[model samples]
Target: MDFALSQEQQMMQRLMRDICSDYGLEYWREKDEAKEFPHEIWDDLTEAGFTGLTIPEKYGGEGLGMEEIVAVGLALGRHGGGVSGPNMLTLGPVFGGISLTEHGNEDQKERWLPEIVDGAIVSLGLTEPDAGLDTAGIKTTAEKDGDEYVLNGTKIWTTGAHVSDYIVTLARTSPMEEGSRHQGISLFVVPSDADGITTNKIDKLSMRCLGSCEVVFDDVRVSEANLLGDEDSGFYHVLGTLNTERIIWSAIPLSAGELALDLAVDYAKEREAFERPIGKNQGVQFPLAESKMELETAKLMIYKAASLYDSGEDCSMEANAAKFIAARAGSNACDRAIQVHGGMGFADEYHVERLYRDVRLARVAPVSDELVKSFVSTNVLDLPRSY
Candidate 1:
């Protein structure tokens, strides 16, 4: 398969890179330090038309596919966004735009799709205190009452909820069956300011600029029209978005690794040790070389998975594998970048530390590497399910 970028794709990359460069590493560093979202940069992205890359053209979007979004993710990561890069677009465009387009009824699409393209921030409410990786075990419930649904439960790690205009939430509509926990779940578009909804921010290890929080739903009500797809079929709908999310999340860290490696290489060539460039030493040279190879290899799988997803193929295995490999490779590259920078790596001014801290979240989030391995073990290797 031809892996080379077409002229259009190259232009997209250049556009994203230029926009991100305007913000630079220092802009990100200050945002992270203050634990503030990068609103200016996000506005820049929206104004530049990057935020609507995945939305359908009819809804004032660019009508792009997963491959194009993946390219945007890579460019954002490589420039200055690090972990927060993909979050800027993913919440609104992917969660709100793609979910509505793929599964929402005509009314739902007409109501939300254009809003997403118009720069409405949409946070996701899927992970719960008890249902981090075990989506089937979620305790959140949405009960039908007349013409509305009353949602009651808690969602943990609801990223960007404080600033988001709306939240795409998943909740159980019925009790779990003995043999099937995936049933009875449903998706809804919840207004963040719905009467009974409350959100409290959570301070985490990284991606401080993008807040993750605990969102409580105490009889939060929404009209029947808020449901995205057929009742009891939200899990299936979520499956479609999850794979796309995996592919883009893989690109974020994968390109963050590229940025880290580039910075380390530049540092190595200039930093002197023992009367010679430290990069001349085998210790530094070997790890950086290994990181380059790993990052390059992961990049290939990331785009391959994206391509498969855009073609409407079953890419669960490939997407999971890409996320697993890219997260590990990206984290390893940041670790090596830190090692190469030596003392400066721990310092924030050099930037590798920030990249390392931020990209490290990829190893555990958007789906953990362990869960990915289990997915591959059962589906790809024909092995028994371990978990």
Candidate 2:
């Protein structure tokens, strides 16, 4: 099987790399420190058409697929934006936009898809304060009221909510039936400025520029026309998008690991220890070498998952495996880079500290590593369900 990127993929990578170069590590550092969104970078990417790689051509997007999106995500992450840069592309276009493209009706798609292609921020409101990863456990309710639905609930970790023009929220439309906790949930395209909807920004250790928030919907009104996909089938619709998310999440950490490895290697070459460069010492060399090997291995899984997704094959196993492997590899690589840098690594000047903070999220968010293990054990191994 051919593993090399095609000419078009290579061009996409180069374009993203060049755009990222204009912003650079210093730009990310400033944005992170200020707890501000990368508006300039966002505008640049949207203007250049990188934000809508997965969107269809009819929607004013590039009409690319998972493989192309993966290429852009890797280049953006590797160039020092950490998870923040790639997230901007994925959360809006790949995650929320893809959901709408697949499930949204003609009117919904006509109204929203073009906006997404033009760089509209679409936040996801799936994780509730109590639900966490158990999406079916969400307490948010959307009760039908004539031509509109009245929503009431709170969603935490709603990324980009403060700046989002629209939030693709999941709420319970009917009571859970026996033996099916996933049923009765539905998706809604709630306008961020809807009445009775309140958003409070959440402070966090990493990805500060992305602006995670707690969104409270107190009798918020949404028209029936805003419902996405079939009623009570939101769980299945979300599941479909999640497979794609896992692949992109895997790429985030994989690229971060690449950046960490690059920093460690460059430092090892220049920093002297015991009258010789650190590269001469096996103590330093081995960890970096191991990280490189792990990253390379994880990257193969990422490509496999993306390819399977693009080919319309069953990629749940590969997607989960890629995320599980890449998260650890990326986190380990960043940790090793910190050790290699000694005291300087702890300081933000070297930028390894930021990478450390950003890559660590891969192990937790979207899906935890432990959960991925459980999924693989049960789903792929034909073992009994654990949770």
Query: What C-alpha RMSD separates each model from the true structure?
Result: 1.0, 1.0
- Tens digits of per-residue lDDT, candidate 2, 1-387, equal 999999999999999989988988899999999999898999888898877777888888887888888889999999977778888876578766788888999899889988888888888898987779989899999999999999999999988899888999999999998899999999999999999999999999999999999999999999999999999989998887888888999999889889888989999999997899988999999999999999999989999999998888999999999999999999999999999999999999899999999889999989998899999999999899999
Q: For each predicted model, how many residue pairs clash, with residues at least 3 apart or on different chains?
A: 0, 0
* Candidate 1: tens digits of C-alpha lDDT, residues 1-387: 799987888899999988987888899899999999888988888887777778888878998888888888888888888878776778777888788889988778878888888788998899999778898899999999999999999999988999999999999998999987899999999999999998999988899999999999999999999998989888888999888888888988898898899999999999998899999999999999999999999989988898898898889998998999999999999999999998889998999999899889888989998899888889889998898
**Would you estimate the TM-scores of all the predictions?**
0.98, 0.98
- After superposition, the stretches of candidate 1 with alpha carbons farther than 4 Å from their true spots are none
Number of backbone clashes in candidate 1: 0
